[model samples]
Target: MLGRRAFLKLFGGSLFGLMALGGYAFGYEPVIRLDVTRYALTPPGWTPGLKLRIVALADFHACEPWMSAERIGSICAHANGLGGDIIVLLGDYTSGTDLITGKVGHRAWAEQLATLRAPLGVHAIVGNHDWWHDAAAQRSGRGPTFSHRALSGVGIEVYSNRSVRLEKDGHGFWLAGIEDQLALRRSIRWKRPFTQGLEDIGGTLAQITDDAPVILLAHEPDVFPAVPSRVSLTLSGHTHGGQVRIFGWSPYSPSRYGDRYVYGHIVEEDRHIIVSGGLGCSIMPVRFGVPPEIVVIDVG
Candidate 1:
């Protein structure tokens, strides 16, 4: 029932409103997500008397020009301060393949990560990236500047996927580290294969009384398939929980073995599997649905 002039005025106002809203709708927006999950589980062999808390960090592609030394040091300090009795660093230390050739990028990368620390000891296992880099370290002449010694210098204990016993608070638990599923390459030159020298899940755990708890630290969650049922809990940080899961699903994870292993926690066949969305960036310097995380897990 409005007159022509009034109709035009109303149309102009409505059009202006739509235009303003549409501008924001098409704005450039980078997607970002942060998820924090607190998991509490009763492992098959957890003892009633002792409590063990471990902070896990992984997939820190600490290559130069990305993760600076100061930044790496800060993250390490933060992980150690989580008040957990133990801290673990899963590998993917650098991205360059020049370690064997002794290059600047490799050296700088290792030196930075050596800064990370923990109280119960910062234990670690190599990822495929670690294995790939080792090939570089094995190079001759102007070999790359990085070395496994870099981690040792900073007091980080790199564990070959094998089990070791720990006595804490008068009670003892076994901390088992496994060579990555990609251990095939690491075994070619090393004295013994990862699956060898290390206790098979059954044998490695045979000596530990049923009452003692076990914490398995591996670089990738794929190890879960081969891990024995005895390990109370397994901590891993590859796949970054899919790094970019949408609606609770990750689009892709570079788990050499399979993309089925994204990131986050999984319980299969009585094993508590926790995969962390590591602290640093990788090939595609971006994380959408999955933000990097430092988990403080408490077990009693």
Candidate 2:
């Protein structure tokens, strides 16, 4: 019913818009940005006049169309250049969907992470995806999860509901990590063979000195609420900063507690939690509004 010229004009404009959006999602947003957000924490045991830098990278989700092995290597190489005192990885190493297996890629990625130089140490913990995939693998006789093998192979200690000390000049604080939130609950729900002492936060804290300031690594931010006041700081990444934020806020964050602690630094009374926007996408390869990031927190 319209003239040919007008119809062609409208069609051209729509095509251009779709192309631009595709470029943003597949090309620019994922590859161009690797934000290094900084935060200052005032933990009770933080050394007066002494500063410590901790670098946290979460939700690598290594696979094709999102994060490749080379991309993961480059990310770690960049983090190494930052010269952080401690490097902590907050899990979700592989994608949940089967678009990419990520087995070989993960191994290569771990090798690159091994080269990281941190004064204190490098530590990591499992996320829900890791547990989920691992569970699936076990059923098929694929043996234990690649996470334990790859991460530990590089000397990056992986902790599950346990605490360890990071010493510098004989002065230090306690760092603890818990298993994936859903995995812990799933074990109870299915009444399957449960791992003893899994996610026993109280038991983990018991190992540390009463006065020692604790830094907890919990992959999912939902665990933030249960973390005690004794835990001075907690590092987490699971919501992916909502992945697709609108109006500087997201309505679809994957959390039981909603977007309260979706991303960046959050202070609850005396406790502090820093959730990274994360370095990779989940479910879909597209990321809008929220880009990949590596968070750096300095405490003193």
Candidate 3:
């Protein structure tokens, strides 16, 4: 029903638009865009008169051309200027996908991350990819994974089912980190396939001796449901904003909850969770509406 010239013009425009989107997703966003997303909240039961600024970096799937050591160093430098009281590293330091042209070694990325600074300290927790990529840890079916050793070697305290109390301005609170929830690949048992997790939420929470408000650092947002209201806030990475979110909805998410826990700040039943879009690519080197990000949170 259309003239030849009109139809050709419409087709050409659509094709060009597709090409531009592909280029942006594959080349520009993943390689060059680094966003700093900030959130401010007063969690329930938070100590009065205590204000804390948290700078968090996550999912540095370090690999050549995508996330180089120099780039990570630059990110750390930027984070240092943010005047955060504490810095937290949410996991996936290893390359998460085989699409990399060259793999960045653990030490290279770890050394760059060591440059991160905060008045309180820099704490870390490993991700699923960190465990999956560590052959020795996978073989033994236990941790200290290679990622853990590298982060520790760089003077970063990697928390595994651990809780530590931190104070600021004479106000005290507990920071708890649980181990990866998908650390091991298990064989199918009785016609069902399930991965084994190293996370011990109960054990970690038990370490908190006082009634101080707790802030939990979990690598994957999928654990949010099990988190009790005792935890004031839960910070997480690993969904990577579904890796290609559009219109605040991710078409594909690795989380079992799909778009429910795919990205950003979420609150349910008076509990709060902030999931970082993260700083690297996983599964593939492509990004759309959800660009790589450094997340900052201000809590009172």
Candidate 4:
């Protein structure tokens, strides 16, 4: 029904728009947007005077043209300057060795991340990508991955199906983490469906009793419902805020629960989950609408 000139004009316009979008995604969006989202957490407890500031960083792919060492260092600097009481790292430190740029390695990334400091402490958990590359070693009784050791070397405790009590000024809260979802499966071969890892929420919870308030560090938000209501908050970062969003929706969310837990804060009853957009990209190094973020949760 359209004339020849009209078709040509429309095609040309569409082409131009696509190119512009690609350029923005590949160039500007990845670097320019570093958002610091602040969330107020008023959990079930009635401690009106209690306040805690937690800075969460996740999914620093740590490779390629996007996440160079300099950029990672800069991100850590910003995190340190944020004045958080505690800094928590959600995983995905590296995509692939092949994707890494010059003068960057797992050790370097770990060292840079080590610079992140807070009065309370720095804590971390591994992601699916971390297990993907080293599942065999991690499963073959090779102890923790080298990356895990690197994190621990810098005083950042990597909690794998474990729990620890964090105390400040006589107020204490339970901080726990489970193994990444992929690590718990029989095998995490590439191209296979991601089954739930052997996350021991009960065992981790058993480490603490008397309900002093709980915050869980899970690499994926899929573990959200598995967490008991005794937990006040859960922090996850594997979704990358859907990587890209259209009118606040991302077409490709790497979550079994779909976009329901894709990004930001999701509150169900008294429990809460904060999914960070994360610091880097996966698959394709492009982000649109949903920029990388460092989430700040203020609990009182």
Best model per TM-score: 3
> Of the candidates numbered 2 and 3, which has the greater lDDT value?
3
Candidate 2 lDDT over residue span 1-300, tens digit each: 979999999999999999998899767887667878888878755556656789999998877756777788889889988879899999888775565544446677788778777888889997777766775543443323678678998898998888997776656778999876665323544565653223668888888975656889998888788888888899999888988887789868888678899988888877788989998877766677889998989887
Across 19-77, the per-residue lDDT of candidate 1 in tens digits comes to 76444322211112223355666677788778777777787676443455555666666
Candidate 4 is scored at a TM of 0.90
Q: Each candidate's TM vs. the true structure? A: 0.72, 0.87, 0.96, 0.90
Greater TM-score among 3 and 4 belongs to 3
Q: What lDDT would candidate 2 get against the real structure?
A: 0.79
- Candidate 2 has a TM-score of 0.87
List the candidates ranked by lDDT, beginning with the highest. 3, 4, 2, 1
Clashing pairs in 2: none
Q: Order the numbered candidates by TM-score, best leading.
A: 3, 4, 2, 1
The segments of candidate 4 whose C-alpha lies over 4 angstroms from its true place after superposition are: 1-9, 96-103, 135-143, 184-196
lDDT of 3 by residue, 41-87 (tens): 99999989999999999899999889999999999999999999999
Candidate 4 residue-wise lDDT at 217 = 92
